[model samples]
Target: QRDRFQTLAEYYRIKHGSIGPLRSWMDRHWTVSRDKIETSELHRLIVALNFPVIYTTNYDRNLEVAFEIHGVEYVKVANARDVSKARRDVPYIVKFHGDFDDDSSLVLTETDYLDRLSFDSPLDVRFRSDALGSTVLFIGYSLSDLNIRLLLHRLWQTWSRSGYEADRPPSFIFMAHRDPVEEAVLARWGITVVTGDDDDPEKGLLGFLSRLAALVEANPSDPPTLESGGELP
Candidate 1:
């Protein structure tokens, strides 16, 4: 039965019965070799979009590297200490799932997730607050990620209970293809699904981002700041 575990967390739980090995595995897998990262077209597009706040569940520092390579000053907050030290002048990269460089900060197993939710950790609190206030754009994720699905579900539940469902800010997800059933489910959560062309998915993504960048540039506005803003670090 121990060998039958399906999830990463479950697999690790059975193998080590602790988070140490999982932490090590993540660190080894996610840590980039170069001090300066080579940015991807997607990463460049994200930087070009100039989103005020970006939240990622990934533990890798690719996004941070992208910002650095583009000469974009950004503050990263992954835990309570980072949150307390986060600066305001620059844009924010909120690492909701912790980072590879910091093992203690990493959230791996089911126990870790439950602990984060139960304690209402700073990351969770900040994410909920940001979700409520901002127009969320989810990229680089799929419905196959149960963790993301559950998180979205919780957010939807919260908004539905707030009694201002009509006034909620719009959220979006970009995907390569559309699933009718999934689209309907996402729609119920107030998240619009954006899909790429069936034949040329990569081109579709590029076109969509290019248009988004143009729009942002044409109608420039102050980027969203944290609730407790401070000077740039």
Candidate 2:
């Protein structure tokens, strides 16, 4: 007889018997450093947009590396301690999921995801605060995660409750392919769905980001008020 694992958490739990080994494995292998980061045109385009704060559901440090490669200074807020170091003058690269350096902060496995649902964690609180006033732009984010959908819905609910949903700054999501169901739902949630020409998701996303970058570069004195909100899966 053989055992089949249906989920990543199940596999890791059975293989290592606990969370410790999984995190150790990531720490030993998945901590992608700046020099180790390969060239990425999409990343270059995102940085060029100059979003004040970038939030990611990714566990790696690729975004930070992108900023470093472009000579852009960024404060990485992976945990509570890192939050104090954050400044308004420079860009903020926030790790909403977790970070390689901190095992406790990593939000992997089914358990970690469930724990974040309450939205009381420091990172979650920070997001709720920043997102309230900023014109957020979500790039390449998937709607599969319940956490993200809940977060988006709650953000809308908060604004609506304030009787200022009409006054809320517009937020956007860039999708490579247009889905009527997704577009309509997001629209109802006050998020405008933006699409591009390319049918291929990666190409479409790259094209979209390239256009935004060009717009920002052309108007340095009055760049678009965009902020980082990506999930590079």
Candidate 3:
């Protein structure tokens, strides 16, 4: 299993023998079934805090469903046209990886990643700009994810060579367990490492997010407009 394809594209190519099959598989698994997600405290907190923008790699529509359930207006941007026409009045949920509704837009293979990287696609540009302008808080990610590490490295490189490094905004990652070595490396990349207790890590993370939500609620800033950016706790 460890030697299996490193990307979904390759996995589907070998297993199902074609992209069509792969797309079908993704549609079957990732499509949102319910009109609304069973809102957890964390989801409710996110809706209550109301960040200006929420970027997700997930193909599922859980975030959008949550917004709908709460009667919060939001724009879901998954392609170039969406980005081009995005408005600032409501929160924007950017689905960078791809959305289940669009098979052509999915980025599931190494080829897809390379294509996006080569062209510096609109989504890529949007994420880079947003990352540079605001404080990014990474959640539900693991240190073992090479893609995220590479992205962080690129961001750090950009900041380091920008000459305004002293004024660069800090990024953060929430981890379930404390790994001193990983923490040190992330610190070198200008990322602050926030960790929860290993014992009952999920509960700890929930508490942490709840506290963050409370902070945002108590100090609600104006929603970030199209011309401006906002920070996530």
Candidate 4:
């Protein structure tokens, strides 16, 4: 039987003792040219959102390539030192999970996930700080991820104890499909659920992002998202 709980990378590490070979394989196979990356609608839609900072758990250079291909300026932040390189003029692409460029930073193994669960890493701290004052819209998350769920609960708990929950800015989750159970759980955390009906997950995400992109093109301003500023607990 296949182990369904742990990620494939974690499984490989447990069985073979190291992910060196796997990482090398991915480096060779996952690499793409800037021209090719520019064609991806996922990249285009994301760039169009024009947020000051974009956070993603992905390790690849997809976002960076997309920004370059689209002629948008962006800085990739993978660690504390990179944070200093970020400027206010361009968007910041934060690699929340880790990046391929840094082997020590990749959150591919089980151990890495456990570490992230603590939610005290430099990147996590940065996220918590930014989220406290910015509107956030989470897409491409299953919400089944324990790390993400715990993070959400922590945010909710913070607002609840702040004696200003009502003043808390709204947060949104965009899902391909709606589940009553998931919605109910997230609702208590003050996260609004949005859905798409395109049948295909990629298409569904594209549709939602397209709308946001359109809205941005019409008005050069912040796209409607969950506002996060409330008095800190």
Top candidate when judged by lDDT against the true structure:
4
- 81-158 in candidate 4: lDDT tens per residue? 888767878899999988888877787776788878888988999998887766677888767688889998988888
- What TM-score, over all chains together, does every model reach? 0.80, 0.85, 0.84, 0.86
Candidate 4 error regions (>4 Å): 1-18, 32-35, 222-233
Sliding window of 10 residues with minimal summed lDDT for model 3: 223-232
Clashing pairs in 1: none
* Residue 163, candidate 4: C-alpha displacement in angstroms: 1.6
Is candidate 2 or 3 superior in lDDT?
A: 2
Top TM-score hit: 4
Model 2 poorest ten-residue lDDT run: 224-233
Flag regions of model 1 displaced more than 4 Å: 1-25, 32-39, 117-119, 198-201, 222-233
Off by over 4 Å in 2: 1-7, 10-18, 27-38, 224-233
Cα-based lDDT at residue 72, candidate 1 = 92
Per-model C-alpha lDDT, please? 0.75, 0.78, 0.75, 0.79
**What is candidate 2's lDDT per residue for 1-233, written digit by digit as tens?**
01121157656876877667776776668666555454778778778888889999777778888888998998999999888767879998899988877878887766777788899999999998888887888876777657788998999999989988888888888877778899888888988777766878889888777777776777788755443332221
